[model samples]
Target: MLETVTSPTLLVSERRVRANLERMAARANRHGLALCPHFKTHQSLEVGAWCREYGIEEITVTSLRMARFFAAGGWQKIAIAMPFNPREIGELQVLSQRVELSLFLVDSKGAAKLAAELSAPLGYFIEVDAGYGRSGVSWRDHASVRSIIRAAGHHRFRGFYVHSGHTYDAKTIPEIAAVHQELLDRLGELQSAFSDLHPIMAIGDTPACSTQEEFRGIDRIGPGNFIYYDLTQVQLGSCGLGDIAACAAVPVVQHKGEEIIVHGGWVQLGKDSLHLPSGPTIYGRMVLLNQDGQWDTSRPMGTVTKLSQEHGTIHLPESLRAEVRVGDLVGVLPVHSCATVHGLRATGDTRFLA
Candidate 1:
């Protein structure tokens, strides 16, 4: 569909996205849970529309701007999936007016104070630090949790939310399932406490949602990475290479010595590092392209060997370099889908389906 697709062009596959979405959605449905997929990973209006096509009415986002984007795209229910930032209060208020905005409140007192000042009725979910130490109220800190909840003081409490980001490091499926259950059990206890006030429990991260089997008390599941199953997702056992929904379409600009250079540099794909056992300098992986626009496995090529601000160097066998020439388009797999998104511009920020 992308006729002019060339170097550094990021493309998402419709079939793979639909399949991954259906698989995850079915898993949640079987357990009677709602899938409120996170929108920050893809950040595409078209991908947002695909989420809706799969019956995802409620969604989660990492920023106020993202929430605004999806709301403008016609999604009426959205949750801002990060700690409250006072500076975005005006944008949040504007989004709240158009759609129901569910804000994350790690500090109950701070959220209550902010909520009181808002001009409209707002809902909130207390962010609990299940295992990830990023930003959340400690799961075991009951007194702090109670104090924070009390701080709400009649302000609407939506429910409890937790994102088990630590699951990304799991080397095995069993390990990932273990972390999923652990998160659910911790959130379940808090859910029992405020049984009548709020009724939804939101947990995200593709690794947990796509692999784990037991999702009993989770009222809603939010997974964004499934849209474009990246190399990270594949390494995490989330999906296979064919399941990758998004990829970078780049051109081979040169074939020097035993290295191949592509127009796609860190500026287009990002310098997301993956720490391998031997070392820690892999920027990304390359997908060999055939004449018919398919991946050629015979020529594995090389990894994204090095990256400067504007150049991407690939180290491979000298034989492969001779075959690839300038003006040839190649596909580079992303280590992290979110980091790849940072390379895109304003139009790249949101790609919609016609």
Candidate 2:
């Protein structure tokens, strides 16, 4: 089946992708929340267009380049999920003129400076740290959060936003709910303290959004990775193995005793991986594809033991290795789909599966 494909290709299961989108859309609709799926995962214009079919118009992006990419594709409502980049204000201004622009800011440092240079009306969401210890102003740091809000008073204030990325650390649905509860508690306090603003709340993280049945008061959700659940998401209990939508088809390049090397590597799949009890896994897990172009997960294919620039070493049980051979196409389920797509796109090593 892969006889015609010579290069490492990134494949998307439209069936799975659509299912993921529909499930999330229904969840958001139940609570009247906007499902602003982040486009940084599947950057393809085709995928973005498919999202529109699911009633998703609002979108989130990680960089200005991405904003322009999606903006050029006619995505009218876009929120730059990352802090405003002073370096690309020109591009941002271009997008603002063409589409509804929203920006995220973590501190008061550049808020006023950015506010003064806006070429268009913008909606600003102050990022609050939801005890994730990542970026954003601490939830307890009301002073900083308010300062950023005040500093960006020139814009149309949207509200407060929290990523809750730490939810990915959860091992079960209850753990995810626990993290989400903390986020809600933090948001509740911040909202009450600044009651005059009546700022809307926005939270997103696939683990929490997919596990929790309800979004009590969230105005919008920015779940991008859920469009292509990775192995990490499966382990976090955010999704099942079947929910994963993206995989890279790489050709077996060499065979060394117990290891089979493939043409895929960190350049094909991103470096985001987990060190499990088996050992330190680098890139992804290998899957054998069926005639229908889906992974035959009824049996495990192998796991990528090591990865480098353009090579991946798959270490499988001897029984599986003997069943597979060099020159064959091996499907690799990346650890992180977003980074994998970014790596594939960045290196121009990409193609779609039929």
Candidate 3:
């Protein structure tokens, strides 16, 4: 299988991926929380099937297109984690009839509009901005939150969906725990305030989901990146480097002294970088591929220091640089596996290892 790689290919390890899924499922079960894992990471039906093996029937996707893809693939319960877009109402209506579709609502206006236009029966969750200012209604704004819930007139108000994405910026496990605690505190207050509605409390984010053990108020978790731990996860103390299940297999194109250029670039690996403490940024970690087509993480070969449109430069030491040649298949453990997979899949260059 290692010999067959001619271009930048996204390689997935079934063993590692299953282990990751099983671990997350166990975590959710231990806390008595429903695991509606976000499938926006791998976006592979093959990977989604693996989630079923662990008793995951509910899933969360980033878009309606992804929801349709998984719905056609037999996922009966799906949640579009992104904010509701009225422009996709036509497709949303079709999808709602096919599956138990749920959507995220951040504003009362959007909810009111949806209530008026939507004829199909579906559930909607209020996306709370729990310190992650990227989107969602501010957790501090109870008036806005209540307005959205009331505006969700006919649609079943599911629960609050909080993505404490800021946890990713934390440097330590304790920092991640602090973010989780704040989220729990906010959700607890929301649940208490809206006790009459009986809303389910839900939260999703790889950092908080992976590190925190006590999900005091969370009813459902939809972590996606945990399915394939990446360098970013490792840096955030969510997972170790050995737990990363995805790698970009690119052919060695040239050896320029200590730098080995590979066919993989931003087009294949994306531009997500990991800033090292040594004052340099790296796109990925290099590893040697064994004959069985698996990456060997035992030996740290080098780091992908630079990436252009069609090439990546791996800064290797003298001893390791001598071991590779042009046309040899080398592996790069991605900094952000989700973005990396998305990039490779866009070019139709990805393979799953059985």
Candidate 4:
């Protein structure tokens, strides 16, 4: 199967993906939290069907386009997890009529606009910033929170959507746990202050979801990256290296001394990189592809040292450098699976192994 690949190709492991979905679903069930797995990681309709096999009815996406894609694929309960963009009101209006739609709003102005423009009864979650600092109204800003909820007008107030992305910066599992606990405490305060509305507390971010066992105040878990654990997840101790389900199959084009150049680069793997403690940053981890089109994770080949637009430089260890040839197909486990999937999806060159 590897012989058929002539360029960069994303190889998804069906077995690994099912195992990942089952694990996350079981984790949610054990804690009695609704598992609305985010579908932004694997944007394929076929992957969404796999998610349903595990009884996932609700899902969260990052954009209106994704919501439309999954809604057309038959997903009824959909939430656009990004901050509400007023520019897409027309598109949002059309989509809200088709499915039970929900979205995130950081400010009351956006909520008021949605309330006035759309009469389709949409649900809205106030985006709360626990510590990620990227987006969301500050968790401490109770005034803004109240204003947003009040501005909902006729739209249903669905509670808070917290993505504790800061957990991704943690260097240890305990650090990740600490960040998650703090987030839960903040959510607890929000829930108490808004108990009258009975808002649902939706928290997500693979690092926190995968590491922390307790979700004291969270109502739903919508982590997307867990479906395809990558090198970053493994580095953060969220999952073992073997749990990674996606690998880019790139044809070895040249062997330059200790470095092997492949046909995969930023356009195929994206620019996401993992900075190692050993002083070097790597774009991805290389694995040996077996004859059956499956990667042998136990025998990691090397690290992708660099990536250009259409070329990747891999640095193999002395012992394994002699094993790879120019014509061989090398498997690259992405540093960030979400970005990698988006990159490959843009080129329309992804395949799943049955």
TM-score of model 3 (CA atoms): 0.98
- Writing each residue's lDDT as its tens digit, candidate 1 over 1-354 gives 333555466666677778888898889888888889888888777778778887889889998888878888898998899888877777777778889988888886586677577857788888889998889888787777677668766556777788889998797788898888888888888778767766588888899888878877788888888877787877778888778766666777887867788877778787787766677577777776654345543456577888886678877655566666677777677888777766854223222222
Per-model TM against the reference: 0.91, 0.94, 0.98, 0.97
lDDT of 2 by residue, 1-354 (tens): 456677888778888889999999988888898888888889989889889998988898887878888888988888888877778777677778889988888877678877887746688888878788877788888889778877886777788889998887777788888889878887888888877888879997888888787666678888889998998988888888888899888888888768899988888887787767566755688898764457856686688878788888888777777767788888888889988888878664555444
Best by TM-score: 3
Instruction: Candidate 3: list runs displaced more than 4 Å.
Output: none
Clashes of 1: 0
How far is 193's C-alpha from truth in model 1 (Å)?
3.0
Model 2 lDDT, residue 214, Cα? 64
lDDT values of the candidates? 0.77, 0.82, 0.90, 0.90
lDDT against true structure, model 1: 0.77
Candidate 4, clashing residue pairs?
none
| Clash pairs, model 3 backbone | none
Model 1 segments beyond 4 Å from truth?
1-3, 196-198, 277-280, 290-301, 317-319, 346-354
Which model, 1 or 3, shows the larger TM-score? 3
lDDT of 4 at 152: 76
How are the candidates ranked when ordered by TM-score, highest leading?
Answer: 3, 4, 2, 1
Candidate 4 residues 177-227, lDDT tens each?
999889989889888988988989999899988878898878899999999
How much lDDT does candidate 2 score? 0.82
Instruction: Report the Cα lDDT for residue 293, model 2.
Output: 53
